[model samples]
Target: MRSGASRLDLLAARDARHALLVRHAGAGHPALVAVALNVPGEEKSPPGAEPLFRWALDQVIAALPGAWPLHVGDDALGPFALLASRAEAGGAKTACVAVEASHPAARLVDLDVYAPGGTVVDRAALGLPPRRCLLCEAAAGECIRLGRHPLDAVVARARALLADAPA
Candidate 1:
């Protein structure tokens, strides 16, 4: 299958897993994390994405006190997976947002903390800065809004950044 189709399939599977987790957890919150890439093309699982994802996950585990390893999906989709854990004090959404804000690769990681009722925790409510663009220091939303850079340029910049990241 083409990479785009494969990505959709992976996403669908991830959603199913999330639903299952919700059903099983009853009232527990869900922490969902995935790798985010700048460009969309044939290369979905870029060179450094898996390592970066793993590293980010490790950081999340360390930050969330009393975290438990529940389900770890395959790295077929560049380390896309979910961690079902309950923190000691703050809710799961708080813990997930904390990890997103503090991770070194915050630009390349998409971490969402979901409430037990399935609502996502608002990053804006937490007062986190807008995500920066992969190619430029500008806000990512602004760059995409203005089409400030070509896809190739952004992809190249992201690749270079990943290259420098320790595997």
Candidate 2:
């Protein structure tokens, strides 16, 4: 895994239980950080995501049930603004935390439901693949056995356009 991915793992481990509040209404959406699927620096994302990155936040929102009130961009940072709008639309009040990860699109389903403050899980969160780098079975086996944490890699990235943009 890349250094960023490793960092993401650490964060996931730390915040696996904490739900970054995005769109809360009495009980807004809470999510975990998993950015293993996203690009580093988020060259594809808006300015903030390109540098800061909030992969899990976006992922969690996508995984949520009801349609959000605001529009979310395919790029990063849009999620935050969208979530804020959704919260108001839902008529619920809650604090939302912006999440970031090196692995883009990584998320934890029902994070707040599982652990409100935050929880520590095993290596499965690390996002180890089934194989060992296509050549190293040992490494792969270790990853499966140890299971790495998934949060350390990503930091929240917001878009400049959305930074000032309202929900």
Which candidate should be chosen as best, given lDDT against the real structure? 1
Candidate 2 at 55: error in angstroms?
7.4
Give me the runs in candidate 2 sitting further than 4 Å from their true place: 1-57, 66-114, 121-167
lDDT by residue for model 1 (1-167), tens: 12555767767756766675566455554443322323334465677777876776777777775565556554324455565566522355566666556644545667665555555555665666766777678888899899999878877776775676545
lDDT value, residue 32 of candidate 1: 35
Question: Can you give the TM-score per candidate against the true fold?
Answer: 0.72, 0.23
lDDT of each: 0.59, 0.30
Question: Alpha-carbon error at 146 in model 2, in Å?
Answer: 10
**Model 2, poorest ten-residue lDDT window?**
107-116
Position 14, candidate 2: lDDT: 35
lDDT of 1: 0.59
Point out where model 1 deviates above 4 Å.
1-27, 30-40, 75-77, 88-104
